[model samples]
Target: KKEKVDFIVLLTQSEPELNIEILEKYPEINAVLAEEKSEKYNFVTYVGEKPIVSPQGNMGSIVKIDIFKNKDGKIKQSLEFLPVDSSVPSDKEMLKLEEFYKEKLDRDLGTVIAKNNVKLDSGFGENHHARYEESNIGNLIADAYKNHFNTEIAFMNGGGIRANIESGDFRLRDAISILPFSNKVGAFKYSGKTIVEALEHGVSSVDKKAGRFLQVAGMEYSYNPKDEVGSRVSNVTVNNKPIELETIYTVALPLYIKNGGDGFQMLKNTVGTVEIDSEKNIDSDIFIDYVKKIKVLNPKLEGRIVVK
Candidate 1:
């Protein structure tokens, strides 16, 4: 008697070379599922010696596989991938989903989070042009972090601010849309010298409108974009006092930055990092709370970052 074998499915987004090695190592593996590289909602399939890159259809996919024994007593396999559309749900399912959202997500909590005097600049789905300027939205977000954690300073990356806020009526969705990453708030102890280096790195790609541009609170500094990279930042101050190179200052920032996201290498290299549990200190939630407490938000371009 012979044993029956089952087909194997592998799901990954690794490099093509790595996928090829996996396919070579496992002959029984029939299909490899992954997100579409083309950024389209449609599903695409590539068959043959190379590893398969299956598209994750806009809503989802239903993959069906058939295995059977051939006349030669060898197993053969066939794959059927069905991409589901957003409207494929039954009427009953739609009703249930609507009810769930109404009970949980859609209800207005009757809370006014913050008031914006002017439309805050943001580049959520656009070119990310806010990374090159001292934006009112960025200032408000950094200030919220500083106030929430009561830290000496707070640093935020412009890339993290996903959407702009219009004047008046800031709701829960508005706040969530502006900071959708849900990164946890964290604190780190670093010397002023490292802080300056981090600032230099933040502005190094200003001409390219890179995401590494910084938005800060509880501290201010000046930089000349025309100056050479790594030497642009100067006149850093914390709490109305000039920063000392050897003095270690506590800083509040997102956990992503502490892990060196957006080229914040100095934050990652810091010896001790204290992360507030996400349940207790989600960035979006904290900022919402800060706004609710303050009632009115009037952040302005106060020369915190001077491009001389």
Candidate 2:
């Protein structure tokens, strides 16, 4: 007594008929089968197999990233597809992958900038404290120059502000953002030696990339890029009059520069210690008061750092 057996041969272009031995020789195919098995036994079987038809090997992947800003932040979602190679990717393929990564980094950086929620033309800290520090710090320097000293111009460094303020109620975190490093503020009296030496030190710092970009509350000067370093500054004026080096004028800057931190050695021994506040965090109070007074983007760049 014998029974009959039946076999079905499925044939179609939809699926490739692969010889088990030949397919095993292909490392890419073996990897694909391994991936399929691992997913099935994983803790969470969330996504199912959705193969991408490619010349090399089909692959599937999912990436999730979160982006936020201000008090309320938003999230963004995306999906990507890549072809798996048996070995290392070719040069052209690597270039394409690098470009994709660069775009991702740029997107993250933009997200960080937007979340700060401030209107300053250039700064690092959060919106509330950073803006307040901008207006207050500039005004503080100006007031010190006009009232404490007989100078009509005062300036600080923009890089002085380091961190950002947290929302609701601000604290040490906010102030740290405004003046993150241990740089102390100082007032110096110079006969226009302030701007000249500052520019010289600035040019010198071009090599080290550590110079504090100058932030001025009053006074103005134009530099000729075509001219030499020391002679680049021209038409320097305070209150509509030319600056006289022989006539001593008071200036405000961070102690980092006065102590020769950013390569300003000339100012190390020339500056005179004057009455001023120590390294303090007052941006939160200043910002809160500013918001209560007005709701607007008042800060604007007045050609402070121009490259033309």
Candidate 3:
């Protein structure tokens, strides 16, 4: 014993394979809490003998586990997940704050920034989220990054897109809600070899619909899903030209990737990185500014990413 502890729970931001590896190595871990979304497991799921629980997406579900000691002193766990809808009462204080936010946005002078003529979706569906694939919303954000920074290429990971805006007015609040993170958009002078490494790493876990799946601007790339992870990416063209392995290209990205977030360790060795101030270059701010500058939005899929 672990000081009167009968069970162990692991909270992780890792993928399913890593989580499974952890459980395999540490038998004491009885439960795993992750951000992975699944349509079937709106409740609970079993991996081997342990149960994996998730909050799903859109903040609409929660898991409840009941632990009990049997007459023989063996521990047992029962898992159940419930949907969190309007039926559940909200905390008055929290509800008040939410209402205040809504009212403030509604009355704000800069609330409406632009008008979107067509729906821009990131492939995050209600029953199934195909967020890893290239999407029009992803391309739009990627375009914003590339254009704002004046770089040869830019990338917007699909997972970063949180919500889809139906065709209509694009508001400041809508930009914030769609790309909610405070991560700053920045750029680096990276060798073509490093770019290849980053792309390989990005699609390494595509089967899991990982957040690393990159949606790109100024580039068209293809991959073989049946190939091994390190060799999957190929036929990459930047700005209508084949990538030159010796060329140093200026690439724009969210600081999360440049700083080695989401397993992009290859970037740690990059040079001439021009990072913008976080407060001035936050993703939501960039998005709002870009939409306002464009004044109109027309998002579409242009075959930037092909899966063979």
Candidate 4:
């Protein structure tokens, strides 16, 4: 009670008022309870900043958790995340990530090829070429899955393409360095409700710097990043038609998004999901190889992702 009272006093703006019940019971807490209630509440409010909810502002940054049991037996976790912002240089973080990737690349040529940059001959122009090429790559991947494995839509992350290939030449290692994080493409079967929740989460997380980038092979959705959570997504279509919320939809997303990365915690809680591991699976690698062989790959907005 002494520590609690001290903490309360330290946090509040006004003096806390005390009820005499504790003094009546034990007679020892009267002095500790002399503070006014208003002060205590004000102090408590200032102890921690309010949680950020809007996409335009800084939502809570990524945090790592380390857990331990307190003396009172309540389990508490300390935030162990590094502080970072847009001002931080990418190279500072690049080397740390590259070292781990180099070790992995040593073992797998497929992974290495997918990460590298291969500048194809300039029969195709840049804008039309890249967008069409990426879409074609997406289509080929989707087609490959459809023909062999039972798959519906294939989705890729636009950010996965680290750099543009020049007409002359480029290194695969350069591409890998650009998109360093080891995220695999993932496919999942989900209920319409689950899909809605996932889209809502994804759209609401887009910041101005980090564009609401998502590549879809099937289905289209438009959402406003400025809108409140759960209200962002609108004009969703599947198979060239409006999406029916009651029907199940098979959608493809990066493995990170499926596992609750990028503020999509709803993905973890949603029920009845079948996630295809992109790393172990041959379908995704074959798709990438097919793209490389074609010498063209690019993705453009097909009215699937948007802002108000």
How well does candidate 2 match the true structure, expressed as C-alpha RMSD?
22.8
Writing each residue's lDDT as its tens digit, candidate 2 over 148-182 gives 33345555554454443333333333433444454
Off by over 4 Å in 4: 1-150, 156-171, 208-213, 269-279, 282-287, 298-300
Taking all chains together, each candidate's TM-score versus the true structure is 0.67, 0.44, 0.86, 0.47
Report lDDT (CA) for all predictions.
Answer: 0.75, 0.42, 0.81, 0.45
Worst ten-residue run, lDDT, model 2?
37-46
Per-residue accuracy of model 4 over 66-147 as CA lDDT, tens digit each: 5566788554434333334665457857878987897887555333343323343211222322221234333334443432
- The residue ranges of model 3 lying beyond 4 angstroms of the native Cα positions read 1-7, 39-43, 47-49, 67-76, 92-94, 126-132, 275-279
Each prediction's number of clashing residue pairs: 0, 3, 0, 17
Give the CA lDDT, 0 to 100, for residue 238 in model 3.
96
Residue 25 of model 1, lDDT score: 79
Candidate 3 to native Cα RMSD, angstroms: 3.0
Instruction: Put down candidate 1 lDDT per residue, 1-308, tens digits, no spaces.
Output: 14544555688754444566777777667667664433233343544632365554333566566677778876666666666766566599788988887777757743566676777776554556568777888888999888777779998888678787778777788888788778888788888888888889989888867668888998888888899999989888998799998888888888887787766778776756645544456898888988888887777887778778
- What is candidate 2's local distance difference test score? 0.42
Which ranges of candidate 1 are over 4 A from the true structure?
Answer: 1-104, 109-111, 271-279
Worst 10 residues of 3 by lDDT: 123-132
